[model samples]
Target: MKIIVVNDSVYPLTMGGSHRCVFEQCRELSALGHDVVCVTANEAAVARVQEPGGFYLSTYRRSENSLAKALGFITEPARIIGAILREKGGEPVACLSVQMFPSLLGLIWNVPKLPPFYYVYHGSYAREMWTQLWPRFKRSLKVSDLLGALYGAMMIPVERWVLGHGRFPVVVLSNYTRRQLIDDLGVKDDRIVVVPGGCDTQHFSHSAEGRARIRARFGVDDDTSMIISVRRLEERMGLDCLIEAYADLRQRSEKKVKLVIVGKGSQRDYLERFAYERGLSSNELAFAGFVPDAELPDFYSAADLFVMPSLAVEGFGLPVIEAMSCGVPVLATSGGGHSDLVAAIAPQCVVPQATARALADALVDIFSGRTKLPDRSACESYARQFSWGRYCSGNLAVIDRVLAQKSPPAQTRA
Candidate 1:
């Protein structure tokens, strides 16, 4: 099978569950004897010379803001158009596209050849912007968040069209996203396939020496409790809520705990200020910025618990699975993809309400010994099922099915 995926970026080159998920799918497809070509706009990949397995052809320079992103989208079609022209066709290539820039543009650009394009739908960014930004806009009256929500509101129709068009098969990363397509946009149920995203279970598996080293690097001692989160420091991530929860947890408990927040974003200065306002001491909280890909495992190994306090619906929490794979218990907000990861292992820890009081109570239960965490071995076993190998295999199976339906078996001579 020849697979061509068009998306904004890939992992290491970029961060985010969607970016990493698509890259893993492409990487796995290439390893499974398919010629995979990833056409992206990630600045890091654009600067690089080459990659292993298949290859990368960039469409735009790296983007940091919405305005730059819109301009980049305007230029994206050119590279993809050239790539399509270069392909020597035999069997129809499966062109996989996820929701970032409008899928309409990709389909419109490829209309001449009209390749067998498949839409691998992640969560709707428009829905994300509206859900996560509107409240902030309402309260702060910030023009920036209003503009973000307005952009999302404007794109809702595009997203709706992408999901509902009968011609394309929508591959969603989680059942939550599948529901969004159906319940929110009226997409037919059969058109959507729920293929859960995966984690590097083996890489994040427990390591004692790694844990000790990571603790030393962070200046956290063995006796101190460590809570770690690797989520992007964005508004929807609920980092502010986590800070409030952490402060409440600190005041209630006699034991001192260390909170290490990793990953970088515009929210850093705001989050730091908020933390201090919430009475979090510098020693109690540390922002490690972005940990490199090579050292992420050690950070997970160092965690006593992993927490995902997302205020909005996550497509799938890859870090939740990664931390669980490392034998660390996870506490996440209920009512989103976070439940998909926690249900089998730490179902009880899903905070019913995503708020400081609720989160603090859950933390108190675990850290204060009121609620015992599930066995580390059980957490490891549950996480093992969500490996990248399994995810890739699932992706291939669906694409193979799609191709088979397109080209039926020829009749034999009587």
Candidate 2:
């Protein structure tokens, strides 16, 4: 099969989980004897023009931040169109779009020879701004709150229109997201399917030597109980709540503990300030911003506990799964799709939403022997269920079905 995968934020350009999924799925599909082409809005994708392993590449100038990228994709749709046109001389192929912005590739140009397009909805950004930002921002009135509100207002209509306009099936990460698209966004019930995000189990597997080395490099001793939360520095990530819980944990636990926060984003300074205000210091709390994807398994292997404290807008908690794959136990809030995954793997670890107190108690129980985690082997076994190979195969099956039934929809964007 010949295929084209569309996503502005793909691997090597952005470390976002959805993009990582795009990278792995495309790579695996290419390995399966399919002629795959990745059309991206990522400026850095120029480096991959010749050949990125088995798949081909195309690039465009997609700038920084959500707002700018949103505008760039709409204003400059030529790169995506040209890539599709170049492939038009061959056998008819299907394009798998990873999100809303990239799904507009054909619609923006009104391409005449477009093939079947399959849409993948990671989550609703509009819902994040509308539901998550308003309550938090109205109190402080940060510029981000206002910007998010505006972005949400613009995205909700475009999101719905695009979902309705296209004659393609919507691929979602979980049952939770499928329910959200159908119930909240008015997408047809049969239009979406749940194909969960997958991890590279081999890369994320346990390593005792790696754990020792990573901990030593990070200035953590073997005796120190290291708790790590690898999340994008954003408002909806619930880092503030996690920090508060860490403070609370310090007061409750008798053991020596340290907290490590990873990733980079707009809320870094604000989140750091919140950490300082909570009485945490450079000694107990460390912010390791933007660790390389190759080094993540080491961090997870070194951690005593891996946490996902997302307040909202988490279509799937990929980090939690990664950490689990490394044989580290996970503690996550019962919000979004984290709960469903956690419940499937380990239900005892899910905490109630928006409460540091509950999380603090859970932390104490885990470290204090009040709550014992399953053995590392058991944990790794559960994590292996969601592998990248399985993820690609599921998406490929869907693409095949669509390719057989429907002709590509004509451009309907206004």
Give the winner by lDDT: 2
Steric overlap count per candidate: 0, 0
Question: CA RMSD for every model?
Answer: 2.9, 5.0
Name the runs in model 1 displaced over 4 angstroms. Answer: 44-49, 63-65, 74-79, 86-94, 97-101, 131-148, 408-414
lDDT of each: 0.76, 0.78
**Candidate 1 lDDT, 161-222, residue by residue in tens:** 75676566778877877887788878899877788889887678888898999888778887
- Clash-forming residue pairs, model 1: none
TM-score of each: 0.90, 0.87
Q: What is the lDDT of residue 36 in candidate 2?
A: 83
Compose the digit string of candidate 2's lDDT tens values, residues 204-310.
99889889997887788978989999988877888888999999989887899999999998788988999899899988999999999788898899998898888
Per TM-score, the best of the predicted structures is 1
- The stretch of ten residues in a row with the least summed lDDT in candidate 2 is 98-107
